[model samples]
Target: MARKASTRRRPRSGSSYRRVKKRSCYFCDSKISYVDYKDITLLRRYISDARAKIRGRRSTGNCQRHQNAVARAVKNAREMALLPYTNQ
Candidate 1:
Protein backbone atom coordinates (compact mmCIF):
# COMPACT_ATOMS: atom_id res chain seq x y z
CA MET A 1 0.00 0.00 0.00
CA ALA A 2 1.13 3.56 -0.79
CA ARG A 3 1.69 5.78 2.16
CA LYS A 4 -0.50 8.91 2.42
CA ALA A 5 1.11 12.34 2.24
CA SER A 6 1.06 14.58 5.33
CA THR A 7 -2.12 16.64 5.30
CA ARG A 8 -1.19 19.24 7.89
CA ARG A 9 1.39 22.01 7.64
CA ARG A 10 2.33 24.00 10.73
CA PRO A 11 2.00 27.78 10.49
CA ARG A 12 5.02 29.97 11.18
CA SER A 13 4.64 32.39 14.06
CA GLY A 14 5.69 35.39 11.99
CA SER A 15 3.78 34.45 8.85
CA SER A 16 1.44 37.05 7.47
CA TYR A 17 -2.25 36.37 7.95
CA ARG A 18 -4.75 36.02 5.14
CA ARG A 19 -6.97 39.02 4.38
CA VAL A 20 -10.73 38.92 4.89
CA LYS A 21 -13.20 39.70 2.09
CA LYS A 22 -15.01 43.06 2.15
CA ARG A 23 -18.78 43.39 2.48
CA SER A 24 -20.97 46.16 1.15
CA CYS A 25 -23.05 48.35 3.44
CA TYR A 26 -26.52 46.92 3.73
CA PHE A 27 -28.14 50.29 4.33
CA CYS A 28 -26.27 52.08 1.55
CA ASP A 29 -26.99 49.38 -0.98
CA SER A 30 -30.58 49.17 0.14
CA LYS A 31 -30.70 52.98 -0.08
CA ILE A 32 -32.24 53.31 3.32
CA SER A 33 -32.97 56.93 4.27
CA TYR A 34 -32.45 56.57 7.98
CA VAL A 35 -30.27 55.11 10.71
CA ASP A 36 -32.01 55.85 13.93
CA TYR A 37 -29.80 55.59 17.03
CA LYS A 38 -32.84 54.68 19.11
CA ASP A 39 -33.46 51.62 16.93
CA ILE A 40 -32.35 48.98 19.40
CA THR A 41 -33.15 46.16 16.98
CA LEU A 42 -30.86 47.53 14.30
CA LEU A 43 -28.07 48.33 16.75
CA ARG A 44 -28.20 45.04 18.61
CA ARG A 45 -26.29 43.09 15.97
CA TYR A 46 -23.37 45.52 16.08
CA ILE A 47 -23.18 45.67 19.87
CA SER A 48 -21.75 42.87 21.91
CA ASP A 49 -23.15 41.29 25.06
CA ALA A 50 -20.99 43.39 27.37
CA ARG A 51 -21.73 46.35 25.05
CA ALA A 52 -18.28 46.36 23.46
CA LYS A 53 -17.91 48.12 20.11
CA ILE A 54 -18.43 46.32 16.85
CA ARG A 55 -15.46 45.85 14.55
CA GLY A 56 -15.03 47.61 11.19
CA ARG A 57 -14.71 46.05 7.73
CA ARG A 58 -11.48 44.30 8.64
CA SER A 59 -13.45 42.22 11.07
CA THR A 60 -17.18 42.89 10.63
CA GLY A 61 -17.21 42.61 6.81
CA ASN A 62 -18.70 46.09 6.39
CA CYS A 63 -17.61 48.39 3.56
CA GLN A 64 -15.76 51.62 4.36
CA ARG A 65 -18.73 53.96 3.92
CA HIS A 66 -21.09 51.66 5.78
CA GLN A 67 -18.57 51.18 8.53
CA ASN A 68 -18.36 54.95 8.89
CA ALA A 69 -22.13 55.14 9.18
CA VAL A 70 -22.12 52.39 11.76
CA ALA A 71 -19.46 54.24 13.73
CA ARG A 72 -21.48 57.41 13.61
CA ALA A 73 -24.62 55.60 14.73
CA VAL A 74 -22.74 53.88 17.53
CA LYS A 75 -21.32 57.21 18.70
CA ASN A 76 -24.76 58.78 18.69
CA ALA A 77 -26.17 55.87 20.63
CA ARG A 78 -23.36 56.16 23.16
CA GLU A 79 -23.98 59.87 23.62
CA MET A 80 -27.66 59.16 24.24
CA ALA A 81 -26.74 56.30 26.59
CA LEU A 82 -28.62 54.00 24.26
CA LEU A 83 -25.47 51.94 23.87
CA PRO A 84 -22.76 51.45 26.46
CA TYR A 85 -19.34 52.95 25.68
CA THR A 86 -17.52 49.96 27.16
CA ASN A 87 -18.25 46.44 28.27
CA GLN A 88 -19.69 46.48 31.79
Candidate 2:
Protein backbone atom coordinates (compact mmCIF):
# COMPACT_ATOMS: atom_id res chain seq x y z
CA MET A 1 0.00 0.00 0.00
CA ALA A 2 1.16 3.59 -0.75
CA ARG A 3 1.93 5.74 2.28
CA LYS A 4 0.17 9.09 2.79
CA ALA A 5 2.34 12.15 3.35
CA SER A 6 2.31 13.73 6.80
CA THR A 7 0.78 17.20 7.20
CA ARG A 8 2.77 18.20 10.29
CA ARG A 9 5.04 21.27 10.09
CA ARG A 10 8.71 20.36 10.22
CA PRO A 11 11.63 22.52 11.27
CA ARG A 12 14.43 23.23 8.86
CA SER A 13 17.93 21.86 9.41
CA GLY A 14 19.97 23.64 12.07
CA SER A 15 22.62 24.77 9.67
CA SER A 16 23.74 28.35 10.37
CA TYR A 17 25.34 28.62 6.95
CA ARG A 18 22.01 27.91 5.32
CA ARG A 19 20.45 30.92 7.05
CA VAL A 20 22.34 33.49 5.05
CA LYS A 21 20.50 36.63 3.99
CA LYS A 22 20.30 37.77 0.40
CA ARG A 23 22.82 40.39 -0.59
CA SER A 24 21.82 43.62 -2.30
CA CYS A 25 23.79 45.33 -5.02
CA TYR A 26 26.37 47.68 -3.57
CA PHE A 27 26.02 50.34 -6.27
CA CYS A 28 22.25 50.28 -6.11
CA ASP A 29 22.19 50.52 -2.33
CA SER A 30 24.85 53.25 -2.33
CA LYS A 31 22.95 55.15 -5.01
CA ILE A 32 26.01 55.43 -7.24
CA SER A 33 24.89 56.80 -10.57
CA TYR A 34 27.95 55.70 -12.48
CA VAL A 35 30.70 53.11 -12.10
CA ASP A 36 34.15 54.62 -12.60
CA TYR A 37 36.74 52.43 -14.28
CA LYS A 38 39.52 54.31 -12.50
CA ASP A 39 38.25 53.38 -9.03
CA ILE A 40 40.69 50.58 -8.43
CA THR A 41 40.04 50.29 -4.73
CA LEU A 42 36.31 49.92 -5.16
CA LEU A 43 36.69 47.65 -8.19
CA ARG A 44 39.13 45.36 -6.41
CA ARG A 45 36.44 44.17 -4.06
CA TYR A 46 34.48 42.81 -7.02
CA ILE A 47 37.35 40.71 -8.30
CA SER A 48 38.03 37.12 -7.33
CA ASP A 49 41.02 36.25 -5.15
CA ALA A 50 42.11 33.08 -6.98
CA ARG A 51 41.85 33.96 -10.68
CA ALA A 52 41.93 37.78 -10.38
CA LYS A 53 38.89 37.91 -12.63
CA ILE A 54 35.72 39.96 -12.24
CA ARG A 55 33.21 38.22 -9.94
CA GLY A 56 29.95 36.79 -11.21
CA ARG A 57 26.52 38.30 -10.52
CA ARG A 58 25.54 35.55 -8.06
CA SER A 59 28.68 35.93 -5.96
CA THR A 60 28.70 39.72 -6.16
CA GLY A 61 24.94 40.02 -5.60
CA ASN A 62 24.63 42.45 -8.49
CA CYS A 63 21.54 42.83 -10.60
CA GLN A 64 21.72 42.53 -14.37
CA ARG A 65 22.06 46.28 -15.01
CA HIS A 66 24.76 46.95 -12.42
CA GLN A 67 26.55 43.68 -13.19
CA ASN A 68 26.95 44.75 -16.81
CA ALA A 69 28.32 48.08 -15.68
CA VAL A 70 30.75 46.32 -13.35
CA ALA A 71 31.95 44.06 -16.18
CA ARG A 72 32.54 47.02 -18.50
CA ALA A 73 34.31 48.90 -15.77
CA VAL A 74 36.52 45.92 -15.00
CA LYS A 75 37.45 45.56 -18.66
CA ASN A 76 38.28 49.24 -18.91
CA ALA A 77 40.35 49.08 -15.76
CA ARG A 78 42.27 46.13 -17.21
CA GLU A 79 42.98 48.00 -20.44
CA MET A 80 44.14 51.04 -18.50
CA ALA A 81 46.50 48.95 -16.34
CA LEU A 82 44.59 49.86 -13.22
CA LEU A 83 43.74 46.19 -12.55
CA PRO A 84 45.75 43.14 -13.52
CA TYR A 85 44.40 40.86 -16.24
CA THR A 86 45.62 37.79 -14.38
CA ASN A 87 47.43 36.96 -11.19
CA GLN A 88 51.05 35.77 -11.55
Candidate 3:
Protein backbone atom coordinates (compact mmCIF):
# COMPACT_ATOMS: atom_id res chain seq x y z
CA MET A 1 0.00 0.00 0.00
CA ALA A 2 1.13 3.58 -0.71
CA ARG A 3 1.78 5.82 2.30
CA LYS A 4 -0.37 8.92 2.66
CA ALA A 5 1.13 12.31 3.46
CA SER A 6 0.51 13.62 7.02
CA THR A 7 -1.13 16.99 7.66
CA ARG A 8 1.28 17.88 10.43
CA ARG A 9 4.58 19.48 9.47
CA ARG A 10 7.82 17.65 10.23
CA PRO A 11 10.24 19.67 12.29
CA ARG A 12 13.43 20.64 10.52
CA SER A 13 16.52 18.80 11.63
CA GLY A 14 18.63 20.52 14.37
CA SER A 15 16.03 23.24 15.17
CA SER A 16 14.67 21.83 18.45
CA TYR A 17 16.28 24.49 20.68
CA ARG A 18 13.49 27.06 20.22
CA ARG A 19 11.47 27.78 23.34
CA VAL A 20 8.09 29.49 23.60
CA LYS A 21 7.77 32.23 26.18
CA LYS A 22 5.00 31.90 28.75
CA ARG A 23 2.29 34.52 28.71
CA SER A 24 1.49 36.36 31.93
CA CYS A 25 -1.83 37.98 32.94
CA TYR A 26 -1.63 41.78 32.73
CA PHE A 27 -4.47 42.40 35.21
CA CYS A 28 -2.86 40.15 37.80
CA ASP A 29 0.43 41.91 37.38
CA SER A 30 -1.22 45.32 37.69
CA LYS A 31 -3.25 44.22 40.77
CA ILE A 32 -6.61 45.08 39.23
CA SER A 33 -9.62 43.66 41.08
CA TYR A 34 -12.32 44.67 38.61
CA VAL A 35 -12.72 45.63 34.96
CA ASP A 36 -14.45 48.95 34.31
CA TYR A 37 -16.79 49.34 31.36
CA LYS A 38 -16.27 53.08 31.31
CA ASP A 39 -12.53 52.65 30.81
CA ILE A 40 -12.49 52.83 27.04
CA THR A 41 -8.72 52.92 26.70
CA LEU A 42 -8.24 49.83 28.82
CA LEU A 43 -11.04 47.93 27.11
CA ARG A 44 -9.70 48.83 23.70
CA ARG A 45 -6.56 46.89 24.40
CA TYR A 46 -8.50 43.66 24.80
CA ILE A 47 -10.68 44.17 21.72
CA SER A 48 -9.92 43.38 18.11
CA ASP A 49 -9.37 46.70 16.34
CA ALA A 50 -10.51 45.52 12.91
CA ARG A 51 -13.58 43.51 14.00
CA ALA A 52 -14.49 45.05 17.37
CA LYS A 53 -14.72 41.62 18.93
CA ILE A 54 -13.64 40.49 22.35
CA ARG A 55 -10.27 38.72 22.17
CA GLY A 56 -9.81 35.27 23.67
CA ARG A 57 -7.81 34.52 26.83
CA ARG A 58 -5.08 32.84 24.82
CA SER A 59 -4.68 35.91 22.64
CA THR A 60 -4.96 38.47 25.41
CA GLY A 61 -2.97 36.49 27.93
CA ASN A 62 -5.54 37.22 30.64
CA CYS A 63 -6.24 34.95 33.57
CA GLN A 64 -9.64 33.21 33.67
CA ARG A 65 -11.13 35.60 36.26
CA HIS A 66 -9.89 38.69 34.44
CA GLN A 67 -10.98 37.32 31.06
CA ASN A 68 -14.57 36.91 32.38
CA ALA A 69 -14.51 40.40 33.81
CA VAL A 70 -13.19 41.72 30.49
CA ALA A 71 -16.01 40.03 28.58
CA ARG A 72 -18.65 41.57 30.88
CA ALA A 73 -17.04 44.98 30.70
CA VAL A 74 -16.89 44.85 26.90
CA LYS A 75 -20.59 43.91 26.73
CA ASN A 76 -21.58 46.69 29.10
CA ALA A 77 -19.50 49.20 27.22
CA ARG A 78 -21.11 48.26 23.93
CA GLU A 79 -24.59 48.50 25.44
CA MET A 80 -23.79 51.94 26.86
CA ALA A 81 -22.41 53.19 23.51
CA LEU A 82 -18.97 53.59 24.99
CA LEU A 83 -17.70 50.94 22.59
CA PRO A 84 -18.78 49.92 19.12
CA TYR A 85 -20.76 46.72 18.49
CA THR A 86 -18.80 46.13 15.31
CA ASN A 87 -16.25 47.85 13.10
CA GLN A 88 -18.91 48.72 10.57
Residue-by-residue lDDT tens digits, candidate 3, 1-88: 9999899987666677575676899999999998999999999999998999999988999989999999999999999999999897
Ranking by lDDT: 3, 2, 1
User: Quick one: best TM-score, which candidate?
Assistant: 3
lDDT of 1 at 81: 91
Error of 1 at 87 (Å): 2.2
lDDT-wise, the better of 1 and 2 is 2
Instruction: Report the C-alpha displacement of residue 83, candidate 3, in angstroms.
Output: 0.2
In model 2, what is the error at residue 5, expressed in angstroms? Answer: 12
Give the TM-score ranking, best first.
3, 2, 1
RMSD vs true structure, all candidates = 8.7, 4.1, 2.8
lDDT of 1 by residue, 1-88 (tens): 9999989997655548565457666777788667778887787677667648676566656666777777788889989998888876
Which is superior by TM-score, 2 or 3?
3
Candidate 2 lDDT over residue span 1-88, tens digit each: 9999999987687674366677899999999989999999999999998789889988999989999998999999999999998997
* Candidate 3: count of backbone clashes, pairs at least 3 residues apart or interchain: 0
Query: What lDDT does each candidate get?
Result: 0.74, 0.90, 0.93
Q: What is the lDDT of residue 14 in candidate 3?
A: 68
lDDT of 1: 0.74
Summing lDDT over every window of 10 consecutive residues in candidate 1, give the lowest-scoring window. Answer: 12-21
Candidate 3 Cα errors over 4 Å, as ranges? 1-16
